[model samples]
Target: MACLIKGVYIAEIDRQENRREDKQIAPTWWEAFHFKCIKVLEDDVDSSIFGAVFEYMGHQIESPKYVIAIRGTMIKSRTAIRDVYMDAKIALNELSHSSRCELALEAVEGIIGSTHHTNVWLAGHSLGASIALQTGRDMAKRGYYLETYLFNPPFLRLPLEKIKCRKIKDGIRFMQSFVKAGVSLVRKKTEEYDPFILLNSWIP
Candidate 1:
């Protein structure tokens, strides 16, 4: 289930990229999920990071939930490689947070400040996952709790002793539990299912 959700966010990122390239105005897959794009966040100062804010309204809900989905490395050129390296540096805390990632988080904070919705979720893939985790940690420090879903996150070499914040440590543990439970559920459900059918149905 975690993998499925991650794939959905990745597909949304691809759709957003295609829309940008073609300059088309079309409904995205999020519409089917009852999510509408509220804001598209981009940083011209640092083009490596980009994200979108979505408002979700499910059938049983009277209020909306907000989601911030960040895009991962494009890897189309040398610049993309540089961006990935920067993400690694940020992960290791060798450098301060990436400007692009910081900008993206600030944008989300701005939206959250103005909105009444209390449920906020964050998601990203690869390098974007690193950014999301870092930003979520910062937000946690600021007393704004956010649930985060990261797919194939980069491994940071920081030791547990180096992390001073107990809240951040707890948050990390929570994310790990959430991911483990999701993987367990997915595996249990697919134990007797055909691999080809699962792949065809899940992969888009």
Candidate 2:
């Protein structure tokens, strides 16, 4: 799998295929020992070849045991502030948008649910961070001990407002650090796809 965003992926292999890959076809216990060290969450599975310029924004490697939902482009959502981006408002509108969070929550409940979790971490990069923040808020309302990591969420609003949202900021820096290291190693080992060149800026 090749991902533009480092640890995240587009999910190429179906569940059945993944199972097959995990357990190789072997004769019997007498057969030669063979093992496959496979990492399903490699960068090769990411969405953009032009992923984060700041690889330090998102998650590192998520475990199957944990229900992790990552929102990609929340900027596309039709929020009340959609027109704020018009003309010179492109930057401001992006900051005020909340509709993307709605989509992210729906996706999380729809895809990552079914199995319950006491601790669920929702994360996103760039504009998606805002969505993650919103999702975390909703998850909290549902009584889930949700932790959200927003990677360089573009805060085009008043500095005070963005600062106010910092509680949800939670593991922003930590998440970026964790993911950046993973992306670097993956890129170095030829294990997965490359990350966005801008990742370094956010990591620091």
Candidate 3:
């Protein structure tokens, strides 16, 4: 599945470089698995292909009917700044407010509406993973659980796992839990948006 997602990245790079024939990644590589590119979602900021939708034409029982793969941050590229901006948004817990996230959710909803939710899968990496995670949560809230794979999703907190002392790590964990509980309580009482509560029914 990761290979198929990587094909999307390669296809975008080839598209940018004008590579074709045997060098093309979309039809050339995906055809091996009987998947065809159905749609290419572009970044509105730089017009770069950020997501690709692939439809499975094979009769294999394990194959997903459709797969939406989202590319992660491309370092040193034109979309890098926008990607980093989204990364910051994740850290700020504002990813749901991103236009790109909205686009991804809309795409997934369109597919699920046209076909069936059980036949679709979502996969993403890094910043794209954040988008995918948020989109999955949104779909789950709507009572549609789509299989999702997220690679290297960002964790918006200090790396407590790096701390050598167990006591300090436990202390930090306790404080973090306490703060989170307090925030959840406040949000619930105020009827504010609480994704954790909304995501209670989603496991993946």
Which candidate gets the maximum lDDT versus the true structure? 3
Write model 2 residue lDDT over 6-84, tens digit each, in one string.
2332222222134353353311211222211122221222222111111112244442233343324422223213322
Measured by TM-score, the strongest candidate is: 3
Model 3 lDDT tens row, 94-179: 98998888888889988988898999999988787888888898898888888899988888668877899999999999999999
What TM-score number comes out for model 3?
A: 0.83
Query: When superposed on Cα atoms, how far off is each prediction in RMSD?
Result: 14.8, 18.5, 3.3
Backbone clashes in model 1: 0
Backbone Cα, N, C clashes tallied per candidate: 0, 19, 0
**What is the C-alpha local distance difference test score of each model?**
0.62, 0.39, 0.82
Ranking by lDDT: 3, 1, 2
For model 3, the local distance difference test gives 0.82
- Expressed as tens digits, the lDDT of each residue in 54-83 for candidate 1 is 777676464348778766666554246656
Q: In model 1, where is the ten-residue run with the lowest total lDDT?
A: 195-204
| Number of residue pairs clashing in candidate 2, backbone atoms closer than 3 angstroms, sequence gap of 3 or more or interchain | 19
Candidate 2 Cα outliers beyond 4 Å, as residue runs:
1-99, 111-113, 156-204
